[model samples]
Target: MRKGKWGKALGVLGGSWGAPPELCPALTAVFQSLVYHECHFTNGTERVRYVLRYIYNRQQYVMFDSDVGEYVGFTPYGERNAKRWNSNPGWMEYKRTAVDRFCRCWYKTFTPFLTERRVPPSVSISLVPSSSQPGPGRLLCSVLDFYPAPIQVRWFQGQQELSEHVVATEVVPNGDWSYQLLVLLETPPGAGSPTAARWSTPRGPPEMPPDAARSKMLTGIGGFVLGSLFLALGLGFYLRKKVRGGAGGRVPPGPERLPRQPGLSGLLGVTTHANTNVVDGRKAFIILSHGFK
Candidate 1:
């Protein structure tokens, strides 16, 4: 059996020539037996194949290919059985020789097709505000788009490497053969204290200042709030003016005149005894005519 570049099984080959009747029964027995042998081969990003089955009892060992990686191993009982059977020095040496021969053959067959595998990661660092249970802030270090899986991430405060208040997530696959890891440092509130995040896959280290980060966040929020408030007030004033102008038209060419009552005219801009009496009489005459009509 051969697997395609994507690790999927391409095809299967089987032959049953010159096999004895006892061999068939033994193969069937091996299928039900717990003892087995398994082998796997892969070319990193592309193809993979697996062969697994009971070693004896009338069955030829099964072989298959798949798009996904496969893991096969004997159970504890099978392991104990093998150990007991191979306890003799001759059997042990023979088993080692067989395994070595198989490995040599597999290497010779597949090593030429394996591609070069090295991919660097993209690293980013951020300061996230967190609650004060552990600290007042958190420094997040993200390593993304890396390959080969094994990576180390570290946190530092000044020249000293920090272990306390540090949390790291497992290496997560990105489903495209790349991986990512997130590390967080719980930083204490301080003034201009610098924290650094370091990673093995990515070379350079990035630094973050606690005070600067917090101040920047606050500045952004304050600017947004102040801008919104000014906008609201401007909109409100414009709407109010629009409604008043639509209803009342332009101001009549002077200071607005008030009704003349029994109050004295000490109020500034208040004309206590102007020609409003004539104006009021005309307005009353117009209202009375309208009412009568």
Candidate 2:
């Protein structure tokens, strides 16, 4: 049925659409309507529901319900409209054919993805000051970024489950097909309250997807750092022992402390004076730089 006919009929009923009889008559009136559909896919079968709501000058006037299969009125003006429209057999047949022509076709064409996507939820528990609430402090548990709408949440104080003065919100849509939920526990303000939250799905909560990957990366980095530190320490000890090589493991002397050999200082034409003498074909020399010996 055309909406223009419905609006014009309500206009002739004389402005009693939830307004008083003494209400002023206007030369122009605003009429609006909302048409919406609910399509469902269940067990491989599709179902559809169609609704149409009318608003006359900002007041709710009438609506057409699929369950009733006809128009239902809200105001006096809309009641007269429903009676007139239901009497017409031609118009009533059009409304009956809407299930196949409008709602069923809409369900088949648009609602192929009735099944919701699932994602694991992340949870956090915090103790926050609450001036507006009855308790001295509130333990707030937020379950974020989950899908499929339905989830389970709980609050715990050590091994005990808490229930009193608990406030929880309905699942809030994040507009990107995910949902969030908040649960808060009321407690007396104090330190050292070990509160926690458990967020689970119907099947049980999976491990956090991002945190699992991050933990692996952090563990590998820690192992690499420890291995490098031990390798550097081992190399340092090996070099120190090589540099101090001798009979008693002493560092070698500098050039100014050398005792003159028979063919070395004269062949290079460089002379170093050290107390030396030959005794029974063995050279005896004095040490110079570190200490005289």
Instruction: Please give, for residues 97-156, the per-residue lDDT of candidate 1 as tens digits.
Output: 543465446656765543224455666666578765544456677777866577677765
Worst 10-residue lDDT window for candidate 1 reads 284-293
Candidates in order have lDDT scores of 0.47, 0.55
List candidate 1 segments past 4 Å from native: 1-52, 55-116, 133-136, 201-293
RMSD of model 2, in Å?
27.4
Residue 56 deviation, candidate 1, in Å?
Answer: 11
Shift of residue 6 alpha carbon in model 2, Å: 25
Badly placed stretches (over 4 Å) of model 2 are: 1-49, 60-62, 72-84, 87-90, 105-115, 124-141, 148-150, 156-175, 182-196, 201-293
- TM-score for each model: 0.35, 0.39
Native-to-model Cα distance after best TM-score fit, residue 101 in candidate 2, in Å:
3.9
Candidate 2 at 12: error in angstroms?
19
Q: Which one is best on lDDT?
A: 2
